[model samples]
Target: EPEVTQTPSHQVTQMGQEVILRCVPISNHLYFYWYRQILGQKVEFLVSFYNNEISEKSEIFDDQFSVERPDGSNFTLKIRSTKLEDSAMYFCASSGGLVVFQETQYFGPGTRLLVL
Candidate 1:
């Protein structure tokens, strides 16, 4: 079995700085996504990518945020400018198929971002 992995499990940065969260999804998966959860809050979808382009995204994925798969196996999320309110646990996920039953997304442990 394979699994998604994230790097730098935790990160701290000053407001206005740029940050990049990295993830490696299970081999052979086709869809990739990013989601965030504030402490005590429900997980919120950020963006979804497939076929090398953005398939869908939420309002939260404003100009300040971007995502890329620089390498076929690694996906990354970049925040242009960090804000105190942007602090949250970011998760990277991937799904191999879209069937109702197999469309489940497997998530990485998460990368905690703290902005000051």
Candidate 2:
């Protein structure tokens, strides 16, 4: 089965630096999302994009964050200004439709971001 894949399994950045994480979502999937887990915290949604625009976004997706489908097969999340609190495991997921019913999201292992 085709699965989502993230690059640079781990990343370390200085506080206030910019960071961009990359992912390749499952082929044939129509929706994409970004979620983060701060150590022991629960997974939180950051944003969701479909049809070339943002569909839903959480408060956590503040001014410092942005996302793009830079190419046909690549999706990326960029943090313009990283913070120490930004250190976490960022997971990329894709779903075919809204999850209110049977839509299931497939997740990549994750890209661990560490800010110092």
Candidate 3:
């Protein structure tokens, strides 16, 4: 089975700076998701995309965040401005089932983001 992969395994950014995290999901997957986990906290859902449109998003996915499929295979998340609170491990995932919520999700290793 194919798996999701992410780039720039670790990142350090200044507060108020922009950052873009990239991912390549399983080629056949139809649903892609972004999640984050802050230190000592549970994983938090950020957004989901399907058919090139946003299917769902959490409250934390405010105006500063954006998702895109720039080409056929790459999916990306951009933070317009980072904050101290935004530091975390960001995960990229993909689900291939017809009903996404019920399918098994394949997750990437994750990108660790730090704000200073």
TM-score for each candidate, following the candidate numbering: 0.96, 0.95, 0.97
Residue pairs with colliding backbones in model 3 are none
Is 1 or 3 the stronger prediction by TM-score?
Answer: 3
Clashes of each: 0, 0, 0
In angstroms, how far off is 84's CA in candidate 3? 0.6
Mind giving the per-residue lDDT tens digits that candidate 2 earns over 56-96?
Answer: 99999999999999888888999999999999999999987
Candidate 3 residue-wise lDDT, 1-116, digit = tens: 57799998999999999999999999989999999999999999999999999999999999999999999999999999999999999999998979766899889999999999
What's the lDDT for all of these models?
A: 0.95, 0.94, 0.96
Q: Ranking by lDDT, best first?
A: 3, 1, 2
lDDT of 1 by residue, 7-112 (tens): 8799999999999999999888899999999999999999999989999999999999999999989999999999999999999999986562468899999999
